[model samples]
Target: MSSRRRLLTASSCLIVLLAVGGTVVAQMEAGDRGILPIDSTGTLEIDGIHVDVGGKDAASARYAGWRIAQREGFKKLWAKQHGRPESEAPNLSDSVLDGLVSSIVVDRENIGPTRYIADLGILFDRARAGELLGMSGEVRRSAPMLLVPVMISGGTATTVEIKNPWQRAWAQFRTSQSPVDYVRISGMGVDPLLVNAAQTGRPGRGWWRNIIDLYGAADILVAEVSVQRLYPGGPAYARFVGRHGPDGEILGGFDLKAKDSADIPRMMAEGVQRMDELFTRALAAGELVRDPTLITVEPPPPVEDELAAIQPVAQVPLSGIQIQILTRDDAGLNNAVAQLRTIPGMEGVGVRGGDKGWSILFVNFRGNNVTLASAIRARGWTVSDVNGTLRVVPALQIPGAPSGQ
Candidate 1:
């Protein structure tokens, strides 16, 4: 099941109090999204550790190599949690995770009489590993966020629609020790295709909220990674810059230098790690706050459920209600029109008029003004009935830079 669906199940009877009203609200984080999850429920994979063994026989040599791998695996986990790392690791004479090592695969190997050399992958029991790391097993994680991985390569920019290697890299990004909770929304359909590189720089609460709603996320994070290579075969350099909504952007970017194409994975991993650090610091400093406007209400309850009885049936009959909507761009305009048609009483949407900065939409809705307004709100939009006339804002994610430092 999706994380959002799981969240709804747990919060079935709970209420989301209005938080944007200046009250000190704590972000209720769920699921695991840390660089090194303090308390992992899934398998803990440790890779790239080298082992060398010299024994009296090939059988003894293999046994010795396996022992070294188990010890080394625990050491890597320790160093990850403690960034400084220790030269001498504590002896694991009686670790609970001793017999819990699920699997060990050789990455690269060379063998000779009475000797063995290999790089290894060790899988440890996640729960036990957390205990060994001395973690409380309760690290607060960030909200589920939609990541728009923008790739600038070969003198051109590639978004989700373009199908580039950079996008694939992000798709395959493993959050082994990362703090960022990335919600990998697919780039299918027209909406994703419409998003371009220029959109990342722009922002509007309405547009962002709409986009966030579409992907069932609470926020948006833009990871702009530009990759470069000197010639036919040279080291590749990846520069990562990140910004998030609603309004905390890191000013500078860090560069990841890779040995070659084979190192792209490492570069991407490093980039995510560094980006996670910036966000973690920001979150701790109280600079990163969740947007209350983006928090969606619970989905409609099932017909067979008792909770459905409490739902209001504020249906309004056809009344030929006409309204005017102002949109920032054609994209928003189309999005607004599509959403408007989803309303029960909304009959049709016609273009009354339009221009560069704004457009006029005639909403042929059948419902009462109040019902129509509530429908818009449920869709993460704000509508107004002014002097018996309606001014509607469509629920769509548009792009623009807000007055954020």
Candidate 2:
């Protein structure tokens, strides 16, 4: 073939490859493979409630066990709250108990023709139970903190990049008893692209601030677990570390071992409980304070004298305010755009295309460029106006963020 023909063929192949890549990315975005967190909010969960009962049939036996679990769980909850023995706990009718119990969680169970033996979790309606205990249900909680459960195995660290037992344990944890207000994300949609193992290593508070704000959290909690497999289907050990903030200040750490692969879930559950305890203690010690750099302190009001001296200026809404976001890839472009749309006064935000490593977004604002810049900066993005075009930069040196086209 001629050189010109060869060049044309290669260009066509490149276009086809680009199209296929774009399709894959788009499909990943639309896929629903992420795990949704269990809803155990606003309920006091009493785990390790054991019940063994027998009946004429398997279903009847299971029902009897669940009823007995409600009674036993109530006693445990009373002792937990009042520091009394289970025998001293007051009794209520089965009908009343039914009203207080929210759901039954089967921790472990065995079923036979006429018997049911199980360890269970009982969720109690906090308000209803509190009324019976003659106390308030209110509990002091810390500022909202984003939880990123990182699992390290085979020298590789991952968080929601792939489903693992560690992530599942954290997602299933009941937060009603925890003092830390943990904001958990279902590792779906673009979650893996955003909250990954590499993201925890980023030390920029500015970048974290943006991410935390997206989740309506004030700070971050890094729950890291390193798994050590002794052998195939043998014992396993895991080291867990609870770190705080973008700097990864160590709150606490511990080690756990599982007897075998089947015991891994139980081990992970214990790890999560211990990790929550560490966070709780850290919060009590005032160690879980939000980073000052992450908080956006609004500009103070102008004094009366300064305000009086200022001349009134006509307000003009800005249109076609070009924002160039620097990005590493298409994911960064999507993230930057999502963050920008959250800022107030930005309307009809639309991408205007850009060269490699950057994307241009044109938005109509309800205010001027100065107000727009202030809003963008509040979201932890570095913004500057150059020749009427706004250049927005991410705090972390991540590619595909705000860079001019």
Residues 11-119 of candidate 1 have per-residue lDDT tens digits of 1236566566787554332112211112323556676778889999887887788788878787886776676465655667524445556556565666778998877
Query: What overall lDDT, based on C-alpha atoms, would model 2 receive against the true structure?
Result: 0.81
Model 2 Cα lDDT, one tens digit per residue, 146-201: 99999999899988877788887887788877888999877887788888899999
Q: What's the lDDT for all of these models?
A: 0.64, 0.81
Give per-model TM-scores: 0.52, 0.65
Error of 2 at 259 (Å): 1.9
Model 1 TM: 0.52
Note the clash tally of each candidate: 11, 12
Off by over 4 Å in 2: 1-33, 299-405
